[model samples]
Target: MEPQKINKGDRNKIYFLVIVIAALIGTNAYLFFKDRQQSERFVTVSTEKDKLRLEVEKIEVELDKVNALNLDLNEKLVEEQKLARVKIEELKAALEKNQITQGELDKANTQINELKTFVKNYNDQIIQLQKDNIFLKNSRDSLQNTLRNISNKASNLENENANLNAKVKTAAALKLQSAEIIAFRTKSSGKKVEVTKSSTAEKLSVRFNVVPNQLAEKGHHNIYLRVFDPAGNLLADEGNHFEADGQDMQFSHSIFINYNNDDSTYVIDWANPKPFIKGIYTVILYADGNTMGKAQVELR
Candidate 1:
């Protein structure tokens, strides 16, 4: 079979068709590549945004760690921390947008760095404050030791002076007169009813009168109470101590009252933590480094 012969008009027509088809193919290829590049760029931007978000989270975690230390922060450091948190929140808000431009991303990055710097400065200040506090504590302890040594060196002479002072204080000390103690059962409605039964007694009601003394200083005084069970065990809370007659003594409760150098009546209501036992309970009162009075109550 003979090959088909090409004429000028037909040949031109064929060339035109070929050119049109090639142009369409090129246009389609260009559009496809452009769409693919745009998709890749979007994915890269999203990934970077996520990474930035994670970095912000890390910074926030660091801030939380510092906050958990519970250090007493000064005014400046507190304000700096507040501002850092605000900046972090702002960055987070900006990054939450659906589309972030490169410029916006760069800006966020710069803000993040500033936030890091602020946190570092805050932490440095906290460390310095801690060091200062430690130094102050050590200085206080050293001064206390030196004073104790001086006190020991003059012990005998101080004792004679203290003895004279004790005589004077004893004369001026407030005394509890007509001191009385009674047991009571407190109801859920907060009413107290007198009770002599050990199983029903929940608290003790103490009443006393302060004897007038011309030598006593008229001012506020702390009246300490000491309760003893039948077993001779002092009833007191843990670490409840007061200074009495140059010695540390345990007491159940202390009351603050005002004295006008005249007879004044006072009351102290004490609730026992443990149930009352069927025995005698002794109540002693002290003020101004001396025993004021003692009273006893029995529960059957």
Candidate 2:
């Protein structure tokens, strides 16, 4: 009976142990399944986070490109604006210079018209004087012819013939009056000078006057005025010519005058129409083969 009881107790103990081991194995299996599910959920979250980070990086790159383009465009705009402003200033300066030149041209035109009118009047007076001289010449010739016929005729009284011949000779001796040239005030002043219209070397205005004499013959005569540099060289070109002392000479410039009265004043203005250098200039007037007057001036 003792052996049988021992066997029963051992079997009961083995069975109880087996039951406890099985319970532990089941709990471990449940815990392992729960852990695996949690791991899968964490992996999905990490993948989503990586995708979001990549998208943000791409957007940042695009923004940087846009900012670079904007900067380039702004720089180009500034350069163009600067170029426009510079052009505007240049145009303004050119316009102002043109205005000044136009004004000067107008004034020159007016003076030239006045000079033309004076020349026309002088020519008319000369024509009238020529007519008077022709009549006088015809009268003198007729009187001389009559005296010659009377002297040849022996029938005429001798004393009367001699007296008439003497009168005829005296009348034939009379001739047209001679012309005189008036001198300038500055002829004795030995100075050389130049005159310019502007300081910028754009143009020059030259002016001079001529005097008339009544004792001169009523005829068309050429007057010459020569402009010279400080070096005593003629400033005018070769085409100009005038009559001086009953001879024709190549001059710088000349004007025609009909002497009808004494103290006739004449003025002439010349346009340089070219650039000039800084220096002194001299002016000389010649008429009837004589130097009538001179003037001098300076320019800087």
Candidate 3:
């Protein structure tokens, strides 16, 4: 059996329907594939965002560790830390978005790497500062020790000088060898006669010989005399005093003598204003602030 042929208009309509169906299928396929590509890109962006978040967290942990060290930071270092933290916060904010571009993700990654470098440099600076502090402490300790040693040496030298001055003062003092005392009276003819009786005595004479000393100062010497009666009463002049052995003492009289550093005999004559007593009279002599010698005479 043979099939009958269709008309040209019917064939053209069928062809038009087939072409429309093909266009619809092609459009649906393109739309479906485009949706799939968008979904994949979104997933990739999410992964990148997660990776960036992990990097930020890691850097934050590093920062926390460094801060825990409690190092002393300078103003410049503190500012650098602030800037790094701000950058990290910006990165975290960008990653929090549901959508992010490759460019933005790459920018975040680059900033994170910069932060790592900054952290490394900051740690290095802290290490250098610690070393410097240690060196300065050692130097200060050494300087203090040196100053203390110098002060000790100076104190020792001062003590030695004081001792030497004391020795020199002792060596320069003059000494007297012997002393004698005599009582005398002036007669009616004005002739002075030596008397043994205290009732007739009007004046007492004290004589002493100074031992020759080269260390003694030569020129003139002021000799102070302290006379005491047998009753232990000092015959002192009013307001007449002199310094002897680092103490002030009242003296009966003072006389000037020329000392030639040779053994020379000197006499001091003292008149008693009161009546002489029948007892011993004692005399002490001082020169150059020292006791030279003493003498006594018995009056009958």
Candidate 4:
């Protein structure tokens, strides 16, 4: 019975030791788990902090870029404003020049109208001068005939004396008249020469009258015209003997006419195939080597 009690005591001691060892092992495992959980939490926090820092840097860079773009836009706006100012000044200058040109045109129109009126009055004076010239010529011819008849008579004294007195009377009746150009006038259709957008040709109509010079030879005389562009270059003509002031000249066109013992009116039509630049144009007319008239026109 003593041996059995001792074996039972050893068995109880072994069991108690095993229980203590188990308790120590459980404590160590609990500490390891807790430490592992803490490490995981720290890693998570560090990763979040890095992400937030990166987002802040990205925001700062975007703000910087926006600032640069704004500066560039401001610079462009300033340049645009300068260019706009220059354009405005140019437009203002052009408007002023146009106004001045309009004023000059009005003055020229008034002068041309006055010239037309003067030419009409001059025509009337020319007709009366022609009649006076004819009467003077007849008186001179009668005096010449009386002188011839007196030269033939050589015999009777009183009869000769009376013939001399009659010849003297006829000589006193004779008169002299000077020949001159009566008047000249030109008229144009006030309508502008229209160049259609799709067409290259244009038509011009001009009308004029020739003043009578009673002493001038009654025959055919050549007439001419010259058209000039705004650039002062002569327009081309396919037909016409181009001469001006007894010199060969480049002309737009020419015409021939017979002025047979009367005042005359003339109208001419001209066709232009060349493209015209937009500006003022001039037309000069010549008759019998003399400048008869001129006209100005504008095109837009």
**In model 2, which regions exceed 4 Å deviation?**
1-212, 241-249
Count of backbone clashes for each model?
0, 12, 0, 0
Local accuracy of candidate 2 as per-residue lDDT tens digits, 1-300? 555455788999999999999999999988999899877765755554444335334433433443454332345444543543353344334333422343443443344344344334533544554566678788988888887887667556776778886555443221223222211211237433342422443322334333434344455655666776556767676676666545776666667766554444455444343344457656666655666666655655
TM-scores for all predictions: 0.50, 0.30, 0.59, 0.31
Per-residue C-alpha lDDT of model 4 across residues 1-300, encoded as one tens digit per residue: 545455788999999999999999999999999999887866755554444335334433433443454332346444543553453344334333422343443443354344345444534454565666778889999998887777666446667788886655443321112111111122365545444221233655566665555544466666676877778877776555655455776567777776654546666666555665666667777665555667756655
Residue 217 in candidate 2, Cα distance off native in Å: 2.0
Write the residue-wise lDDT of candidate 1 on 180-278 in tens digits.
Answer: 889998788988899998999989999989888888898888989999988888889989999886789999999898889766778998888788899
In the range 198-269, model 3's lDDT, one tens digit per residue, is 888999988889888888888898999998999999998789988999998999998999998887889999
Q: Candidates' lDDT values, in order? A: 0.88, 0.52, 0.88, 0.55
Steric clash pairs (candidate 4):
none
- What is candidate 1's CA lDDT for residue 228? 93
Cα RMSD, each candidate: 22.4, 40.8, 6.9, 42.9
* Worst lDDT 10-window in candidate 1: 114-123
By summed lDDT, the worst window of 10 consecutive residues in model 3 runs over 165-174
